[model samples]
Target: MVRIREDDINEIRNKAGIVDIISRYLPVYRKGKSYTALCPFHDDHTPSLSISEDKQIYKCFVCGAGGNVFSFVQNYEKITFPEAVVKVASLIDYPLDYEADDVREKIDPHKETLYRILEDTIKYSMYELNNTEAKKQYLEGRGLDERVRQRFEIGYNPPNDALYRFLKAKGYTD
Candidate 1:
């Protein structure tokens, strides 16, 4: 997965017409450079949801539900930011590639340490299974391929206390 570039995001913003997208959920009427629809986030008799196609943003002016296209979809669909981006991109027939490396780099140090410990544990488990013919045969008989195993980070944990000892030796505590 690759991160969505800044230029690509701008393209999404420009291509996903605010009037067109909002009309899909509610009846929108053109009012000069903007559009208005009934506020879906709150009960209202008059149209209060204002959408600016020029600004690529929406505002309720009633319940204060407002933001750009991405945020509007996020609130309307009750989905995450990335999901909203994908939804908007799909609406405009735009392609997107997702990457988690940036998010991982921003996580707390303690969480990063836990991730490292789990990675080391997986390596240790794989090493421990190197000589276990029975386990290998079991996995193979189950129709698992080497590529699938590697992709899923599958590893064998011995029936004994080897995994615990390995973690202990690596300075991991319960």
Candidate 2:
């Protein structure tokens, strides 16, 4: 599950036009301000795919399949969402720097369990910090604001067996 930044996704969408991308796959004819092409999604069509260059979207009136540039590539190429994003970016020659600021080291196969446990622990701590007002106040008092906490990946460990219970429920052993 590679998490791409929303900003990068928007930028790519803005840069890549719906008409340009769809035209690469099929022959589209100008119909007023919009374009029309035979809907590849279904059989025997007379230009049912209505592509709006202004809206940057496409709709197959027969099949009811419609979406943006990324979705068009995704469906057309039969690729995953992330792969479609990369494909769209490549098509427009847009450089995609989607990796997070935190440079995580690659985990060894042997240490996979440990890595999962660490990730679970982080999630549990984050939940605790969010739910516990006292914990939030303590962090705020110590000058750890929301932005600072988010930047540092700060979290709180509640004074209870919550973590133990959470790990147990997740099937992580001691």
lDDT of each: 0.82, 0.87
**Which digits, one per residue and each the tens of the lDDT, describe model 1 over residues 1-174?**
336678877788878888888787788988887789998889978999899887788999989999988888888899877778888989888877767564556668788889988899899877766668888778888987677777877789878898888888888878
On lDDT, the candidate that comes out on top is 2
Worst 10 residues of 1 by lDDT: 98-107
How well does each candidate superpose onto the true structure, as a TM-score?
A: 0.52, 0.55
- Identify the leading candidate in terms of TM-score: 2
Give the range where candidate 2 is weakest over 10 consecutive residues by summed lDDT: 98-107
Instruction: Give candidates' CA RMSD values in order.
Output: 8.7, 14.1
